[model samples]
Target: MSASNHKDTYQATGVFLVLMGILYLLDKWIGFSSHGLPWVMQKDTMLLYAAVIFLWFKSDKSVGIILAGIWLIQNIGLVIALLGQMSAYLLPLALLLVGVILYFISSR
Candidate 1:
């Protein structure tokens, strides 16, 4: 394949991966009930995923990493809450670690 075609394939794969991740997260958080997609996924979460996918596809690493940190925290908070571990304060600490990692990654 030509160099440009190879790059386009990589970008398309990235977009697909992002979408799949978003769908997985959504399914984990909110199972498909009697209602459909519209009522299943949260608006803010969808928008956040959209931003992540867009930035990633555009090859904007720094902003994508920052947004990914936010997404991780949000999803981890939900999981921790569901497991009744909210009193441990681990969610915030884990988020802090994720933030630090994101900062370091963006700096590079």
Candidate 2:
């Protein structure tokens, strides 16, 4: 990658960090309720945002995609709960599918 690309990547990372810090401060000072906030604004969404930034500004996208997939897998239960779905085995089944897919993809 060119120097410009490297600079952009660093700038994006810095901006993300700064924004997260500001959000953290706001949450602390204003006492925002986590349940009342949108899912995107939740603290756990930082990883998703960082993954998006990595995909957008980085030359290589594989790492970003992998991180995003992992985040989805990790939070699948939360997503299902939010959607008002109550399947006891859904989380495990989703995880198993993701694992199989990842295994196949990595073998190529």
Off by over 4 Å in 2: 38-43, 79-108
Q: What would the TM-scores of all predictions be?
A: 0.39, 0.57
Residue-level lDDT for 45 in candidate 2 = 85
Tens digits of per-residue lDDT, candidate 2, 1-108, equal 688877877876887788788877887776567547656466458888888877887776776788787788779777778756555677678779979998998999
Prediction 1 TM-score vs. true: 0.39
Clashes (N, CA, C under 3 Å) per candidate: 0, 0
Output the worst ten-in-a-row residue range by lDDT, candidate 2.
Answer: 35-44
Q: lDDT scores for all predictions?
A: 0.64, 0.76
Model 2 lDDT, residue 34, Cα: 58
Q: Please give, for residues 54-90, the per-residue lDDT of candidate 1 as tens digits.
A: 5656444555556665675667656666769554786
Give the winner by lDDT: 2
